[model samples]
Target: MSMHQAGIIEKKDFDVKPYYNQLSSRTTHLKDIFEIYYRYEISKEEKFVMTPGFLNFQDIKKGTVLANSNGADVVADHASRLFMPLYQNQGNDGFFAVRKIPKSFLLVSAFCRKHRIDKLLPLLPGISWKSKDKDVLRVNKRVARVFAKQLFHLMGYRSKTWNKEYLEVRNREAAARYNEYQNEAWFRAAFE
Candidate 1:
């Protein structure tokens, strides 16, 4: 009474024609998949904002009263590039400033990152690699009398903390997860 004895050769003998037919009707477009991946690849910005000055938009002048911090009117000690005057009741920051980065800057940064040029930072007068990985830099403010924070930013170093002897800078690229796409079939398929 077994199926093997009933005349059926085997279930594996079935062709399942519809399955092959369906595969033939469908096509996997690499471009479509890449577009979806590209959509997610868009870079994000890091914003510095304060609660009290959350809504101020006008240009803040130097010495402008920013907020009442610790019962003291927080005044702009220097000229403001942008201003967020404190208007909110419960907030810490008085204002934030934003600027547009040029496309060339991004292009140059990518080139530097791809080539691992940041490793050379340790050769500078006051800069040294924090670890063997060379992902972080320790900057001695005294030795780097001429170097500015903007220069480090241009090379992808950000999120800085200053101690008595050195400024610790972490690479922005290290925090970004762009490497996830490196081994993606869709990413590799484009070149092939």
Candidate 2:
């Protein structure tokens, strides 16, 4: 099935109790079934396969196991560690490389600043006023303007505008069967 179809399946609200119970009864090791499925899915040509959706702790733990077993690297902290190596590797060429700030770094910095502001709100009553009056929240104007575009690009997103007013961005990497259907006519018609 196409990644689009799989995504639709994930959005449906349905109880899996009956399916899970039946499958569990037939399997001596229930986790083995999950592992087998995970292996089959990842063995395909796709470079990446994100989980169906946001998962709870137990599901995340299980996914980590499946990923490790299938020789897939799972990054829990994508916002800091994802692209750090590229920056570190560019020794003398760092000047050119640093021109484009890593999206992960930007995201982490934004989160930290927001958190700091939140924490200081109670302790420092005039913090919000000072932040606005002094323009303390502003980063470089050029960087601020291009930050969202750069960040989205780094996260494998491509944007297109419809009707000249509505902007839409989709992550190309979100597809589990990207390689499998990339060359298909329907896939191109829909996504390309």
lDDT of 1 at 33: 12
For each candidate, what TM-score against the reference? Answer: 0.49, 0.18
Candidate 1 residue runs with Cα over 4 Å from true position: 1-56, 83-91, 99-107, 123-126, 140-143, 161-166, 179-192
The model with the greatest TM-score is: 1
The alpha-carbon deviation from the true structure for residue 30 of candidate 2, after best TM-score superposition, in angstroms, is 46
Q: State the lDDT of candidate 1 residue by residue for 1-192, as single tens digits.
A: 133323344546755566646654663321121100001111133222233443323445777765544455656565534433434443444345534456777667667766777878888788898888666899997864567776787688887888899998999766656576557554444334
| lDDT (10s digit) by residue, model 2, range 1-192 | 234344433424655567766756765432321111111223343344333333211233222322221346643421111111212222321111012344566565455443443333224322221242222222233433444554434334453333332334443444347687677666565543
Question: What is the Cα root-mean-square deviation between model 2 and the actual structure?
Answer: 18.3
User: What is candidate 1's local distance difference test score?
Assistant: 0.57
Model 1 residue 24 lDDT?
Answer: 46
